[model samples]
Target: MERSLAIGPGCRAAAAAAIGLTWLTVAPAAQPRAASPFRLHGTVEPIRSQLVTVPRLTGTGFGPLIIIHLAKPGTLVKAGESLVEGCRAAAAAAIGLTWLTVAPAAQPRAASPFRLHGTVEPIRSQLVTVPRLTGTGFGPLIIIHLAKPGTLVKAGESLVEFDRAAQIKTAHDREAEYRDFIAQISKRRADQIVARGRDETELVEAENAVKTAELDLLDKDLVAPIVAEKNTLILEEARAKVAQLRKTFDLKRRTEAAEVRILEIQRDRALNAWKHSEGNADKMRIASPLAGLVVLKTIWKQGSFGEVQEGEEVRPGMPILEVVDPSAMRVRARVNQADVTRVRVGQPVRVTLDSFPSRQFTGRLEQLSPIGSPSGLSNKVRTFIAVFSIDGSDPHVLPDLAAAVDVDVK
Candidate 1:
């Protein structure tokens, strides 16, 4: 019986070991825990990968993140909601004066909601070309004279003034001679003057001289349509010259029977001369061709006609100033080629810009490229673009939002 008990204990232990081994094998299969999900730490953006940029310092993380519109950080902001605060002092001031223009259509058109998923752009191929002013006879400035570098100008403002000092001196000398001739004639008796006929040529020239002085008064007021502020200083000296001429001279010619031909000839010559001078003076008025946010450009080295400063001689057709309207805002984005097939035109999408991280604005797929193109943020394989229209009402959409577009293939 004792032997039997010992064998039973051995049998029990072996059974227990076998049970333990079986339990261990089944536990792994029967009981499982889930793998944790990935948490993406980014501000709520109009796009998935990129940030919607605002003038507000943010998710760019160049320095520290500057939060704008703290109250609605992750909430829906209204159309006029002050989404950001504490911007650069100049930027804030410009908002009132800054204006944006919708691209004028070839046909007069009604307003339509446009699908805009383009880079914040300035030249849209249709903006009116900047005016170029060139002059002849004033003979291309013997010495270069330029307008002020950074002066704010009003509409019909003057930009630069040619040194008319030499012209003034010549006019003054002519006037003195004319006055002397008139004095000489006044001293002579009328019959003696007529018989001599020597002073007739002098008297005619002096009359013409007075007429030229009157023309000078008109030529002096050089004015341009104020294209924008900071075009240059107004042609103050030129206007003053016109004022001086008007204050000093009076010449009236009567159309008598014999002298009519001579008067007509003089009038024709003066009219032609005035036309040329007026056109030349118009060049001095550099006005903003369009209203927009003015950002001074400094990339002149790259074959670009950058911002022109006062005291710089600019030809007509040179871009002296720039105005980018804030209202012309468009959101731009990059998407992957691997996922390119899934994208199509008119796809609905959403965007969250880095500037207003918490804001989510809905968009529609506006454009898809016919051909594949290469992109930096895209995979090496050729990728296609998928543009979506964003809510234009949001002023936060000013520009440069590193936006990602989620195209809903479904």
Candidate 2:
């Protein structure tokens, strides 16, 4: 209070500085307190199934150590190999790779109302006939060689040959006759030539005798008148003789020429006969007119069914074989009268061969028989024939093969 104080601006500044230093030292020395720890208090609870029972594992050999290896759906498996392992009961139940085999799905069924059984046949076929042998007098010619059934032949190919023994003999005989006629004609011509020359010489001698008698008449003029009359009579007789000789020679020449003409006619006839016999021999061979497969025709004789074989005798104009075009084939099926109405021409059809079940063919109904006939054992069961034209060709598609035909309705 009573003290005297001399305070300057520096002294006031030093005192404030000393007060700030003292507060800084005291603040750091006093640290803040730590936070309190949290407390957690709870208990374990039991699990409960709602609206369903949760069963516990009770089977034998099935517990926490249970293990199983399941096979995939498309896994390759061998016989006696494990397919499902783990549960012995399950493994034994499904053993030996028990695969439920199922056949492949069937093809789509066509909208066909009915089917019929039938045989395969050719659409175009020709009958082979035995050639006619004329003027040879040979009947039922013997067959030397015959073509086997199922032989493919072309047009104009030789198919049959008849026995030529008889024909050969006939041809040789006719030829000899022709040669003999030619020789006779030649001989006749030579004789006629010689006979004409002799007639000319005889005519000249008769003319010379007449001339000599007339000269004797000239001598009679030098002698008595009675001698002249006798000479004239002798000349008349000689002239008459010459005239008779010339007439006789003309008549002989005409007769000889007529005879020669007759020989020429006979020769011509013989030549014609020879040519005819040779032609008959050539006609013994029969040729095909179309290209196709050969089918032997069935011949019924004496209650036996057979075909023309080699060494067999066949009559002229008889059917020996049939040539069928294998390219165009058809199915001839007999349908019941009740089902005949369902089939129509131009309808699509499905054909299957009994020999080859895997193969299938498509065709169209080409024709339907107008008349119905008996088909079954009883005459009351009548059937109508139906023809189907095949669309394509196959080697296995031959005539008479049993086939099944399915026709599509409408």
Candidate 3:
């Protein structure tokens, strides 16, 4: 049985209001929405970059380098542009260069979906250093010339020049020694020829004497007994003299040949030394291998790390400068291990430089490291390196500039 109660207008209005409030609360929860994309931070850098270092001098007893010339920072340079000049001295000195901007290039169409943060670096780069010498004990190199930093340069241009006085002097000395040996060898050969001729004359005379003695022996039977005996003794003496001369002649020839050979060896050694010194002198000048911008490296100086200056001393193999090709640039970034799966190779990305937030560039994910490294925040957390290749060129998109990257994962 249904029980009907008396209804009032106010009760009906209050019941309708309660039903409306319940519907409002549940309606929004039933709808679907999209998720936010993950973003990564990185730095803008050329894909091609190089580090320059002080050339490690080859051989022993090389003194310290003294900088005589240095390029000013921020100067545009091309390949093979002179950047520094130096010479060897009792004290040491150094210089450095830093590559800055790159020319614009065509964009790559491939894209990736993830964002990562890293520094920009060039894919192709070259490190410039002093040329290693071929000769030993030549003192330190002194900088005689250097290319200005940031200058545009072409391939195979001079980047550094060192004082070649010592090398030149050494080469001259070696040449003199080599020539002296040559002269001595020539004289020895001439003397040996003269001595050999004399010995041959004596040997021929001895043989003739032996033949005469043998003829005398043939007539021994026709002479008196005592005379015949004397002839026999004379023949024996002649034969003995000839045999001795023959043996001595062979020994003398061998001895003379050996003496000449010794001189030749000495001459060859001196010639080699001379050639090495000359080659080393030529190597004192350093050249760039590719077209790019010059970048000076910072080195320890006066108790602080800074740019190397002229008239300073530097050791061999210390990094001094770099030539970077800036046409193509890429950003290297790190992604959290947990979020790495959200990103894939070839995903499209948007890059914005922190220095110029108003400027944005498009790129694609180029590479994702297979292994993860410690994140430094927590022992359990790891981060993977991600490389993003920028598609278009921006003059302001220089290396080492901090940048933010965004990817549309949806």
Give every collision pair in model 2.
none
Candidate 1: tens digits of C-alpha lDDT, residues 77-178: 443444444434434443322221222223333333222233533222122222433323343222133334333334334333444454444445445554
The per-residue C-alpha lDDT of model 3 at residue 284 equals 72
Q: Ten consecutive residues with minimal summed lDDT in candidate 1?
A: 96-105
RMSD of 1: 32.5
Residue lDDT tens for model 2, 10-82: 4545675654422222245556568888899989653531121222334454332223555554344444444
lDDT of 3 by residue, 65-125 (tens): 6667676654555666666666665534422322233333335434445545567776667
Per-prediction TM-score: 0.35, 0.56, 0.66
lDDT of each: 0.45, 0.79, 0.78
Candidate 1: where are CA atoms >4 Å away?
A: 1-118, 122-130, 135-277, 286-292, 301-316, 334-337, 373-386
Those runs of model 2 whose alpha carbons end farther than 4 Å from true positions after fitting are 1-124, 154-158, 218-230, 287-290, 330-361, 364-388, 399-410
Give the higher-TM-score candidate: 1 or 3. 3
Best by TM-score: 3
